[model samples]
Target chain A: MEDFSIIKQQDEILREIEERQPMFTPVQDFSSLEVEYASNPPFQAKIPYLQSKYSGFRRTRGDGNCFYRSFIFSLFEQLIQNKSHLSNPDSPYSQIYSAIKQKVLDSGDILNAAGFLPICYEDFIDMISAKLEMIPTTEISQLEDDFKDKIIADTYVMYTRFIVSAFLRLHADEYSGFVEGYPDIVSFCNSEVDPMNRECEQLQIIAMTEAFQIKAEIEYMDRNDRTETTLMSFPFEYTGPDFKIHMLYRPGHYDILYPNRS
Target chain B: MATRTRLLRELKGKTEEFSLNNVGDDLMIWQAIIQGPSDSPYADGKFTIEFRVPENYPFAPPKARFITRIFHPNVHFDTGDICLDVLKSDWSPAWSLEALCRAIVALLSAPNADSPLNCDAGNMIRAGDMRAYNSMARMYTIEFAQERNLN
Candidate 1:
């Protein structure tokens, strides 16, 4: 296989995804996954176990961006669930939101340092700030409604995608060792990390979670993944606090998981 | 907010390449001008551009098009729709309108025919007919975008 380089330019990328994918598809409730998992055998062995653990999991469009999209919605869900705890300075949700806002602002600096097109990063920051400013009026239950508004959800997800891409490229030297056989860290990020529809790998995941510091846990649910150690924590250095999030990972995809002890 | 602040920054930092055409204080809908790059077909041309910002300003790229009609592989002849990546999906708020104007002027000198919004001009260049393309492009620039039209 040839080495990975930045694939199609922007116009081509937009056209490819335009025919089949919507910018943001509304996240339906979790009941739908229960139905699909019950019928599909490949996912059968894990259904009973998964159903016992998660109340519902929304499936992002399998456009190779399932990971980031799932992460945003899952974080949103957690934010709403813990909204009343806002006054607590240690609130995990509040911390993540503020961190996100800072990341949006800092993205400008990163883009400028790297000498990328200014308008591209500038416009994304604008969209990101608009959503961050809407927090006071955004109710917890209406979180799904916000997600339903394609514009609102797309804006937030685009913000996350942009930050993750910029973070990897800007700090290329620091994360270079993570991906082997790439031309260089900058090129690796341009092709792998920056572009939309590119799937997230271990290195990308680590950089993203660490940059934002939103502690995360992944419970693997694959055919070969049935051991007590299936679930794992990111950052590999977690003495500060346990993860506020619990996600179920199935090879290429990830979704939120809520344990149903009841 | 980002777009509004950015327009003000551009207004304050006006350069010789492009100047804001509107003084009405409507930041959302802006008019601007760019002098065609030297030694290019568009040289001596004064092109007007319309900058339209959506309510979602920086989130979505501000839509920009040439109000001046000219012949170029990267720019559409009739609508003056420019085929610039920064103006499209690659657009991020990191850019100010001033930067966009500079890039547009740069596009005047170097037209990438690989992906053409104006196939006629694009095909002429793609066929490796630089002599024909330059003359035709010059024709459009002189006829539609000239010094006489400058405000």
Candidate 2:
């Protein structure tokens, strides 16, 4: 009675929904929710509102169950796909950046309480790529315009977080005691260390200079295959730490020689 | 019928009845026994493989594992996880089951060492030590797949 035009618009949207039914036919099966609820009576007791909302409101239990399951399933699917993308070597760095952006958007109370940002594996690659570009190479000027500062900054922070997290997960037995002790290593390292500065690069060079330091540590800690060595070893122009930088070596693959440390 | 379904039917008629006993609704797990391709390290071998289809179906790619062990850079030793992209992110829903089976058979012959599932195998292959890789392949074939009976 109030607005005939608004009612017509609503009807148009409803018609669109009806037209799209065939496209969504696979997801239309919600009858199983009723059977699931009947089998598991405790679920109704725990979430009485769910039962009330569906059954009391004259909506089928199957509809509620299907909707919930589909939502949960899609969420998990996205997580796995994102994780796989991160682990994939061939995936472009931008994919990881977008994933990080999505994580920032999706983050809420649970992630905030955990005190960590959700970053996919590709984010790690993006971080490494950024730091690698900043090593003041003779070839630095030749780098593509796409490889610039903010990307480098974001990547560096994300990479450090990934490394610290991986180190913690891998060496939980050796480092679990230190978990409570060093609650904010990634944040502290990122803020205080300044990886962009010459000092941090020197520190990284020193750590890497020992033959098999990164390799042995990563192998022992991560338990992942050594295949990543080639990908991990790029970036480290000598910061005057009594070490000879070897070219023609793979990125993640390196054999560090530390004459000073020895 | 879908191209995949049709292709699957054709392959089933041509090949021996190969199926896995244990599988869930989410996973369309199958055990395949493939005859080795000619002029390959895996020639004259009958290799076994396992396929796992995810619940997300066409969106997320399925996972494939070698049930019968083989010495290859693209496959793990203890676990049979393959390192090929076709099975991973590069997978397309357009890929047919027959094509996947053929690819698996082909992978037995040629392995990409640049991206290796087994570092030792990759190292050996990269070093051009084909003898070592072949011997290892032969050994695994004998140990895991009863290659002696095939010959």
Candidate 3:
């Protein structure tokens, strides 16, 4: 009875928030964030440093799916914006896109090996592959519109979550040591990575980046009094190509960040 | 499109243990008939469950409740609502309608008395009265979960 009522309350609150906000808001300047934190001195102090590095950011709804949602949207936006290079077979962007697309398709084996039925995840794989195939020919606005469609956006996020869960489950020995409260990696993935609206933590982020073979940089922009926000790369010691996805992380939420051109 | 495909696939995978069907030709509403586990007191019974697929299918768990009443600790006696973690917080995109029905069948044999939706069933189990609990559960199984009742 207590559990039932608590879930009901959560649903009501989530519905109210959903009505007031879109899943993905258009990109906004750093100054807008400054205005939002005017009353908080620590956050205000950190804004100038953020503004110095990042030109702007797109705000994803603060729903627990923010991290994965931001990552997928930002990654697609990067591909869409550079579609000219992506379309040219000779370009490095085109090569990278080909490699990533193949890997995304190949991830189905991982999902299957982890004991998930094809019917359960094949549609998700199809959805992701179709979107990836559209990247070289589609416009950024089209991508934005797709993300605005809740069903489309959630399917992408859900697939991303499954890949991460699959990676962790298959490589349990490597991750079981890091699982804190849960008995093992499988249960940890079940509780944290598998559920919709469950917040993403550091372990899941590591698993997602590794599984997709995509480099990502997350800038920590919290309310703490830090002179500069910390830019942390997944695969912490990554010395490979530049990160393709950049996100601003503030406590429990994440938003896409666009770095200023040098 | 994905939901319909997945449900149609499930409809084709029906077995003697469980069978799935669209309620009134509506894909969003489904009904399943589960054969009781052999080792449990519900051995001779068959249970019917109603599943309401949410808009975000697979990502969100389908809403499931027993349409055939039974005596169980984790299932509400009056409302038939079940209180399983997988149906709530632990659901994954990897799980399908077939998987969920299998879990419900598993739950029938292993009832968690700690968080009971049916107080009578929970109290009987807590009091360590196996004779009383088994008979009551079997009696209800015979009364409401007969194969004819489901049909």
User: Which candidate's lDDT is highest?
Assistant: 3
- Among the numbered candidates, top TM-score falls to 3
Worst 10 residues of 3 chain B by lDDT: B9-18
**Model 2 per-residue lDDT tens digits across residues B1-151:** 1223323443344334343322443225655677767676677678777767665333235677887777888888878887765565344332434456777777877788887778898899999999998888777776667756532
Winner by lDDT between candidate 3 and candidate 1: 3
Tens-digit lDDT string for candidate 2 (A184-262): 5443333322221112222232222221121211111122333221222312332221212221111122111111122
lDDT per residue as tens, model 1, B3-103: 56656555666666567754476778877788888879888888999888787655466678898988887777888877776676355444567777888
Ranking by TM-score: 3, 1, 2
Tens digit of per-residue lDDT, candidate 3, span B14-129? 55556788888798999888888998989989998999998668667899999999999999998899999899878877787888899999999998889899989999999999
Clashing pairs in 3: none
RMSD of each: 6.3, 24.9, 2.0
Listed per model, the TM-scores of chain A against the true chain A are 0.76, 0.24, 0.95
Give the residue spans of candidate 2 off by over 4 A. Answer: A1-262, B1-27, B147-151
The reply for model 3, stretches above 4 Å from the true place, is A87-92, A237-240, B13-17, B146-151
Judged by whole-model lDDT over C-alpha atoms, candidate 2 comes out at 0.42
Relative to the real complex, the DockQ score for model 2 comes to 0.01
